[model samples]
Target: MRQKMLLAFAAGAMLASCGESENAEGPEVADLLFSGGTVYTVDGDATVAEAIAVRGDKILYVGSAEGAKAYVGPNTLTEDISGKIVFPGFTDSHAHLPDGGDTILGLGLGGLTSAEQIVHAVKAYADAHPELPAIMGSGWELNLFPDANPNKALLDEIVPDRPVMLVAADGHNGWVNTRALDLAGVTSETADPVNGRIERDAEGNPTGTLRESAQGLVSHIFPKPAVEDVVRNLEAGLAYQAGNGITATIDAAIMHDHNEAAYLEVSSRQDLPQRVRLSLLAAEEMVTSMVTPDNVEAVVEKLVERRAQFRAQAKDRLDADAVKIFVDGVPENHTAAMLEPYVNAPLGPDHRGEINLSEEALNAYAIALENAGFQIHIHAIGDRAVRVSLNALEGAIETNGERPRRHHLSHLEIVQPEDIQRFAPLGVTANLQALWHFNDAYISELTEPFLQEKLHRWIYPAKSFVNAGARVVWGSDWPVSTSDPFDSMEVAVLRKNPDDANDQSWIPEERLSVDDMIKALTINGAYLMGQEDIRGSLEVGKQADFILVDADPYKVLPEDISDIRVLRTYIGGRQVFSAAE
Candidate 1:
């Protein structure tokens, strides 16, 4: 009985024309009624609803044709979507929107094969902005270079007169010309900072490349862009997110600078199409602005007060529940702390991943913050860093009893199987970006020699994590890779390198199904952010946040999934972005 009825209703919901027959007398009135499509409501039991009726911003009804009709009115418009698919709006769990936007507008040297090509691209930009003091570019690939490392020598050839600095693709390193180095006062005599390294050539000469905090040395000397420029970059990023059906994103890093202030203004004005979860970053010394040693309790109180102000102003547009902490940088180029020595670096055998803070310091800070009811989004890319974070998290919880707040390991790019189980116990979410599997070919090669037994393991272990009952959400890590959720979904399922077929993909068994992939991009992401109760899936009372695609995902082959186009995107029942209209 009830089971049969549910199955029949689900069948009707899967078909586009079934709803029409239910109301054959006339069209049922609805502000918007989408019928006849594969609608994936990634809610409990993974319900497949037939028709979704929207009245204003929230879902009026979501069920079979019979259930949807009760909410219809005389002026409602019904859409026949027989050849389409509807899923909750995607969420990018971690990305640098402004950086990505600026990169898109700047010189594109993401995959240049050699430093010479990068110099040429910079020269082309210089030709137009001849009066500009120095050239600033980003997105350089070390793997693409013949020497597998870039230095200032390459930049000197093309622009010896002008100071030039190019940030590495990972955002952890920089390559500067000799002129830029001299202007910044970084020389062979400059000692490497605690959390950074200055790469050098033979005879103790400073090479053009600076890793981690060392890059900050050269960047501080450059003139900063205007607030209008930051706003423009943010607008570009917002448009990009809307085009890709991304409804929200967690910015990986937010510094206490004028650019951030301008971003908040833009966000409060709703100029940003996508919702932002801003996480402020600060050093231990800088924490005094919001906290003090004598009145640490008062500082926590102020942090909350400030967050409330931002939330009230931005309304549903901003979430200020977390603060970011950079645990360590990337493992490539020997900046990312590793438990073992680099497989192919000049460094000795006893090298380990860098720790920006002592274990005690990290544990104490996290505990204090958690007790104050603020979430901590830790940036940990390497396995050693993950271990340190896990240890710190454990210590923090021990000091302060477990609370309902969420903790995240922002780029869990390399997790051991054993760590997967710990995530659920530790209340940590794996914020993974699957698109890296498509764009980055060096990850596997660089990791193989280090983890010999677990060589070439897939970074986003979707199946294993799901099996372990661990929550896994997808992210774009944009600016580092393309910010297309469809592209990311396509890569996660197919496990095929679209960029280079010759590059073999690993752990095919770890790939997720289309159904699971949709959930990770939608409800799972919402769940991680504590927004699942109001948004995420399509259901009665849930916000009408979804996108309509041209082709039905169920009918298309996995490889052809990326061919599906987003025709329209709706947020809170409003047509925020429409491609056709």
Candidate 2:
């Protein structure tokens, strides 16, 4: 009887410490408490907890169910999860939300395998909306066309009278009908730009296919969407991100010339659901014009004033981290600058892979930007362009040393192992899109013949970089790819085309664990943007940004990882997404 009394006294003391009262009247109090679920907190130690507590946009406690219950107050909202899984809200390091929104708003031809199907979809959309002036569409694959490349003649055959401009899946090219060409004033005499190709036939006639810079010819003439339409599209994009449990996204390339004002206008309102980071780009000539020798001090003062005003509103959301410079186009259309001649089709005696900037000019630009303390994200695809970019980066580091600010390599599709090492030392973050591994079969076909075993190892080389001590971050390259972090994570972990059965995944050894992958999508990205203390993972006193899934990725088979559904997304203690009404 004495031993039993002692045990009862200890138990009572424990209950008291947990703040439990046997005679309590109301429902268990907690600002937000969830139990009967697995919480995979991607903390530094990767600890697992049974429950979490939130209070006014911050996580107050994360421990046992009993511990979380202690924070319950009179008006607490308690949720019994009954064995679900939760994780930190996903963050997309790179995206094009507005562009993705625009594409989703327009005709979606992503899955169509043939021209006939595209025609049917286009005709159906036109019939449904008779008031549309021109039927514009995007996401057509070059392989789907008869010539292995698209042409306006085919679109002309489908809808001869109506003008159409359909962008290729890669976004590096487009196909416009005769009417669109006529409207854009693109005639037989129009010459291709220095870095872009205007596809031509044996007779030297325009073939309606615009490659690289030439696509601008038709794009400049396309009608702009109304403000209302823009708002709808932006909302659609945010909804898509929220639905996928993404809390933040970085717009990889922001064409401020066309849409910065609209972004400011839309963002001024309260409709933005996801946090946005926009990278600004200015033409080389325009950048030079801003810093002329005659009025350098005045220009610097003006830029500082403008930056201050932008900072006052943005605080952390908007950043002018870098000025984008296009060194060369993609390797798909034979425009990317390469060290060696392509095996399939060698260039003539005078021809080489297209180099947009001469070495002298590029070096000068790099020095100037480095001196001005601007991080540069150069578009490099071919080996030669990559070399040029590396040289420029080396110049920057030699002049300004390395710092926390990360220089980016956009579409770094073909990095040599040595170049990755160079990046680590220079503090250049490898902002890679793993989904590109599943897509871009055309690239595989071209690279396989020459690169052999090295063909598909470039996209998201997680294991290699981690071993090398490089800070690698995951990005969706949205609009170019889906913004869904789950989908992106699935692709990274599995390294296979979820849709293709016959296609093989490259370098199975390159796969990373779920924990590492989540860190890349969360903490690493947060650290890159310098928001580690405020966002990233769930911890006491941190912002309450998290997502609850129907299943636990840690316990599930890797193949089923992609299918795990998102039940709800919470940001700042508010329910941003919930399955239940």
Which 10-residue span in candidate 1 carries the lowest summed lDDT?
A: 1-10
For model 2, residues 252-348, the per-residue Cα lDDT tens digits are: 6655344555565555543356767665544322111122334434433443443444455653445555556667766666666766565554345
Relative to the true structure, how large is the alpha-carbon lDDT of every model? 0.71, 0.67
lDDT over C-alpha atoms for residue 286 of model 2: 13
Q: After the best TM-score superposition of candidate 1, give how far the Cα of residue 311 lies from its true spot, in angstroms.
A: 3.7
Question: Per-candidate TM vs. native?
Answer: 0.88, 0.86
lDDT of 1: 0.71
Per-model tally of clashing residue pairs:
8, 2
What CA RMSD would you report for each candidate? 5.7, 8.1
The 10-residue segment with the lowest total lDDT in model 2: 1-10
Which regions of candidate 1 are displaced past 4 Å?
1-29, 65-74, 111-116, 270-272, 284-309, 438-440, 449-460, 501-504
